[model samples]
Target: MKATQKGRSPRGILAFVVAMLLLSGSLRLGSIGIAVASSTTDVDPKLGNVEAVSECVTDAETHELMELLKARSEQISALEAEQEKRQIELANAEATILENLSRVEEAETRLSQTIQRVDGASSKDVNKLTSVYESMKPKDAALLFEQMSPDFAAGFLAQMSPSAAAGILSGLTSEKAYTVSVVLAGRNANAPKQ
Candidate 1:
């Protein structure tokens, strides 16, 4: 009997573990009580009661609910912040796009005006010079030939009548006409041909 007691000394620890597992499993308190009463009459004073179990379950559930609510609140706040940032970025991008489009429109208008001004001035200058060349006699025209390019004379001469050209040609000295011819050969007589 003494050897049996010494060898089986760990029986108390096994019983404690088995009791805990039984309580935590499908075994009800009534079954545990019956089993314990039949096995050992000595009841442990440290064992918790039914009220403690109810309170523990309630507290654990309450803590879990609080944690869930806290996580939800934090998630909502983060989402709201992200949404606000995106909205601001969208507004800024839209404003920048509108501003760039406005600038492009303004630049286009200015470029169009500049082109019109250049074309108008060019047309006016061509008309004015042609009129001046036609009004002067050939001899007087020859005198001004040095003032303008020979190509200008040749183009103007081509547009005038043969009789009128002869008068102008007769009045001009041969040396001047020869110089004009040489200058005309080197340049396009119909420059700005358009």
Candidate 2:
């Protein structure tokens, strides 16, 4: 009976250790289940709140970008309007310049016509005076020529016929005729040959 009692005592101690290990394992599993349940309940709302916050940030950024685009668009429109106004001013300035040029051209044309009429009348008067001098007697013409400058007398003689000019030259005093002859000879000395 003592030998059997010793054998049962060892088996009882082994059974006590196995029961404590099973109880500790079950407690750990129960604690792990409670942690998983609590984490799921807390994390779901946190994830939803994070999504909402992300959406709000995206909306703010979009609104800011829209405002920036609107400001830039208005600035561009102002620049375009200023450019158009400058173009209109330039066009007006161009029109004014062209009108002034046209007026200048008209004035120049009128001045030219007036000069032509004056020149024509002067030419006719000179021609009539030359004819009167030619019709006069050589003695009378020479008397008038003696009182004139050498150059002035030479100009009249040059416009007459050769016979009429010779008659007047023959009637002049030798000294006066020589001076007038010198003036007529040299009158065209500076003329261009071409």
lDDT of each: 0.72, 0.88
Query: lDDT tens digits, residues 48-159, model 2?
Result: 6422122223577889998899999999999999999999999999999999999999999999999999899987887888899899999998899999999989988999
Looking at model 1, the pairs that clash are: 138-168
Scored by lDDT, the top model is 2
Clashes within 3 Å, all models in order: 1, 0
Pull out the clashing pairs in model 2.
none
Model 2: residues >4 Å from true position, as ranges? 1-79, 173-176
State the RMSD for candidate 2: 14.7
| Residue 130 miss distance in model 1 (angstroms) | 1.6
Per-residue lDDT tens digits for candidate 1, residues 109-131, read 99999999999998687767757
